[model samples]
Target: MNLFGYEIRRKSNNTASNLPASTLSYIGVPPVFQGSTETVGTIDTRGKAGQAKAYALCSPLMSVISKKCAAIKNLRLAATTEDGEDLERPDAVRTMSHPNGVQGIADFVAHIEAMTQIFGKAYIVRMESVGLPEAFELFVVPNLCVTENAAISPALSFMPDADIVDYTVTICGSSMKIAKEDMFIVRDASYDLNACGGNISRMVSLQKPVNTFVASYEAVHELMINRGMLAIISLTSGSGDIIRDARLPETESEKNNIQQAFRKYGIRADQFKYAITSMNAAVSPVSSTITDLGLTDVQKACKKEIADIYQVPSVLLDVEGSTYANAKEAKTILYNDAIIPEANNIFSVLNRIYGFEDFKVMPYYDHLELFQESKREQAAGMTNLVNALNNAVSGGLMTTEQAKTELLKYIV
Candidate 1:
């Protein structure tokens, strides 16, 4: 099958028996290894979208970041003048409220944010009617049925410097080509020059922390499954030789007796307790306590690193010592540093696609509590400034023009 301009062949059950000599030579399979049952792993050449999606699904920290970034759903689209005054929503912009008939704008933005966070790029096909876009369809990333081709005609390119000509999207065995002009792409930074500098996925750069988180999660899972065992019990003779025959209970009666003894003398519900084993068994700790292992510490560190990469605050992920003040501050930082910037980036591309001549489409966040708090603070500050300016002018300490200039400084 052709994937990202490469043909990948699947190994059949018969292997060498079904293949011709020329085909085997072309694949560079050695004669001795051709029929061998050893299976070789194949690398995914398209990108790390699959791996990133898997990480986002399995890793709790990654999932938190994904959900936090999905706050883009809170943003409302509006048409705004150059001076930042809100204008009436345009007919074309209103279509975004229900991008497709199946989902509302909240769900649409959530999916877009999640995809952009995981895959570093998102494709939205503009379904048009009479040279105007009526709806948009979001394509799933890392889809095997999707293929992006380079522009065939220089004059017909979507963007002057963009190389992508069109996207071939196949769904449910049906395929269609979406031209560049009809597709809106939101992408992250890329360092490569090929294929319009293929987007650099955030998850690709977070492999280290994500792996650390996975390893820690697995370790905790195993510990839980083993009932938090910290030591290994072994039957040994006085001379330090292991008594293999006595290591395990021989009968059901013996097993019950051992369990009874442990319950009676071993660590129990009592706060202070000791184990008095009648048998000559040695207790050697094969693993340390969770504290000694620093499992929580390592996992917390990994979580913080992952959150930082996604521009999410650790406090928002329920980190310890999260005060009300700090949590509110973190929310402000989240909107300012992450969510709003991401929305701006996405809508910047959308504005161009919608091609509105009078006003541009932008994200409105004034309804958000964080922004509301900002407005309240501004109002309080402005009131105090006006009162002070009036007092100064009435007291003859400053002229009216000077006071007006001071007020302008504050307002502007």
Candidate 2:
């Protein structure tokens, strides 16, 4: 049964269990649980499903949440860890071995290790959907006032006002997909979508740097008057935590308090515009690495486009020709060294935003260089390493029993 539009029973068992206004939506991590633990891990991607199965386990709370959510359908609940585990078990978190990349193995292990450290035995629901669909997608009537030009209206009346190419860019999110426009205020050169999609084009388009412009404070609020922007936000180098801490209440009165707080923190609307501009320009620094990509340049005009992209900042870029005396000096410019300065500033605003860490860059580069120094070493050690893994699993570093069970997932 599709079972769409059916609301699950709430804890209070109210006849109409609409989600609480405070219901935290999932964004990799559910909002209700606030603390996060960041760790380095090795995911076991040798077998395809190994990675997927384990990543969810790393931040195990969601699994618990999913399990509790499944209780409505009477589905069997059977999920655990290296040791006998349960939603209430304290030692639920365990560290996974470290290696890098999104391979079924390395990525999987990293997540497992993260969950072990951060969410060790925290309150969480569990789910079992070996057979049935886990979550339901329902179509409900729109929530809104009957407005004019319902269809043509921009997805969001007030885009989370942001900076694109230095010129204030409105980031309007919409349930209805709309064509995106970009501007290059730096070179006064804007380009529209090339109508192609690939990692190659994602990188090739940015052969030349696009200069982004910054907008004025007055322009930010004035643009909101008519533009159908989705969210009104201040995107900036400032941390996410700082932005989320806004005391703006749901009512207009709250806005005054929020304004005071904004002013107190020097987060005037112009500064908010500055943040978006920083984010737009930030893409170039991210792209300087071997693999970099981002939004199209302006010329196309209009401020509405949406995208989520990542880069492999030229890891250890410019490290050459430096006189290094020791490993400490070498590490000072490694992936962590190269990316963290800018990255930490990006997430410091928020509690712990993912995708800012070093490992997130591994997926875009040549994998073997990750552990070894040269291509020759990678070629020389690959077979032996794979054999070593198999032997170790057969031996006891992990276990033949474990590999036998997990590796079965990748067998075609």
Candidate 3:
């Protein structure tokens, strides 16, 4: 079906809440200093200096949904899938750098607000990391806390009588402009696929020139809020799609800096054993990825997932009157017995799996609906696809004559 016929507004009898500013505040990198520890990564460099690398990271800002008492009973985190049930333990790690070459934080935030269509008011965080390396390096300094320019406040969408977000949104310098729209179900995204209005698409597409867009509530603490880690708690009331473009220097430079920095920093061939290794960070990877692919008894899967979160191996999950309070208490027991003690015993092992020990407890995140294509990614994909197809044929995966046929099959 063609996408152009979609209308943005659907008339209603009630009034809408005035939307807030879209570009709330800006997040800035913490200033570098002479004594801070350097975070290095995995690449061996040709020994260069002064290359600028910038990336955005994200973390989940968790809070109880529907209440602020530090607890929400039976806060459903589990879901059933073909494979099994996903025991709802939302364990948030920091956002990894995105391969799409996405840069500025503003563009990142816009992508997130549009995602309310699927995940309802959940916990999230967005962050950006900028490095000025003559050669890319990944080095971490302990006790370093960075800050951002702005933060989104506790705002949820609500129509006069409606409880959910069914409207399209455009956020500009601290203002949120909303328009009504028609939508249809999409098997992929958690919410119905939002067919864009001419205005929404254009507005979303405009973010490339900038970074990501985020919330206004981050300023509750210091002027330079914790860039070390971030959390997003959105009460969007189901805000619909706001589009985003894929092209921007922000995306490319961030990755280039990280990849190159590590190469440049590592292979120095000396003893800094605990001296410093490489550090890799960037925007999170979001594709039309339905990962944790293919399983049976998704409910069982959920059970396992919760077990992993609590670090309570199945042998330990007492099925004795398993209530949520019991679940919470059980997790606490696991945390104290296995999780905490194990954490101390396997510090290095934890760092290897969890980015860094710090990241496991706290980090940053980029909040967005996962399946839609950002303009930047959409365009970059084309050039790469051509090269990929040619390489496939050269490797004898297909005949030269069959290359075009093979390529077409993958593009759509």
Candidate 4:
């Protein structure tokens, strides 16, 4: 079903406190670099631009990174006991399934998409009434809520009397001013001293690699355009000579006649040729032999660098020469190294917010077919261990209870 049929507004009737922006003066955070919006992919030979422009310029870089993040977002989530045992989800967690036909996971994924797009900084403002947060809305921080082309002041205002924060500042174009308990923020924590906490977007570490990747592609495109434009070299008897026809014109009046001569005669037609001669000038067209740019090698290296940042293998990005076996191995590495770790990071923050002491929420993907091989290997290893324990018990090396006790370690 299409959810974009009409405008969706928050159902909460909470009003923004008529607080002044000056009250939140001390609560400051560094904003993302906001120069004029630029495009990197456009035909420009200048050096690599900033992160925002790189995203606009490099298609593959954006695809691979966003795809990885989205994969994490779409992974199935489950509530589990502290012991890592799956449990029935509580009503509080199940609040994601709104009666308004919006899926909680979908809304959450949308925010995550924004987060990954902007160096992994995402703010989710939860709307609450009577001390319970009911709904969530995402806002782009440091990038929006502009005043006179400059980013607005702090979006967060503190209310000491209520002991809760008032998030009543406009973000981007959204005007939200909910209580502190109702809002939850997640950031990548760049560790900049100027920014509040270590949550500022990492200026150097995050963007440098991405810039290199973008620059590599931009260089390749520029080279291709240069090759196309300078392919033909004109050799003339005199400097004043100009070749001016679909085939070479006899007079200066035919200067504008240059067009697609190859279409009229055909490519490499030695028998169908034209000659140009004048009182003191003659002209000949020579196709320059352009050297190969080794673009394939450069692209592979750039792609590998990108995969390294995401902890994913180049094979998963469909890097050339990847075999099926290596791709599968790469997928395993990606799941264990990148996706699961990211899932843990996301769930850890959420679990802290949910304040579940005895239980924790986690993304569960044991059901995914891609991970089945790992599970199968684990199961087989466990079965072998159990059999060995059984043999030990039968051989009187250990008692049945002792074997059971030993097996519990492996099971847990």
lDDT of model 2, residue 296? 21
The alpha-carbon lDDT assigned to residue 34 of candidate 2 equals 19
How does model 4 score by TM-score? 0.64
Top-down TM-score ranking: 1, 4, 2, 3
lDDT of 1 by residue, 300-404 (tens): 887787788788888887755798999889888888888888888777776776566677878877798878878999999999999999999999999999999
- Identify the runs in model 1 with alpha carbons over 4 angstroms from their true place: 1-46, 90-93, 129-145, 151-161, 189-198, 226-256, 259-280, 286-289
lDDT of each: 0.65, 0.26, 0.28, 0.52
- Taking all chains together, each candidate's TM-score versus the true structure is 0.74, 0.17, 0.15, 0.64
RMSD of each: 8.1, 28.4, 31.9, 11.9
Q: Tell me the lDDT of candidate 1.
A: 0.65
If the candidates were sorted by their lDDT against the true structure, best first, what order would they fall in? Answer: 1, 4, 3, 2
Residue-level lDDT of model 4, residues 1-412, one tens digit each, is 2121224566443322343533322101111111112214222212212444555655656666666666665566677788888788776456432312334664565455445344445545443345546444333333332111222453543322132335554543456455556555565533445444434433234454555555555444344343233324343445554555223456665554443442343224453444343434433433232235454665667777766665667777777678878877877777777667666766676667656678776776678787787789999999999999988988999998899899989875
Instruction: Give the candidate number with the greatest TM-score.
Output: 1
Weakest ten-residue segment in model 3 by summed lDDT: 46-55
Candidate 2 lands at a TM-score of 0.17
Q: Please give the range of 10 consecutive residues that has the lowest summed lDDT in model 2.
A: 300-309
| Residue-level lDDT for 234 in candidate 2 | 42
In every candidate, how many clashes are there?
0, 56, 100, 4
Write candidate 3's Cα lDDT for 1-73 as tens digits: 2122233465453322232333222342123211112222211111111000111210111111111111111
* Runs off by more than 4 Å, candidate 3: 1-30, 33-56, 61-412
Error of 2 at 311 (Å): 11
Select the stronger candidate by lDDT from 1 and 3: 1
RMSD of 3: 31.9
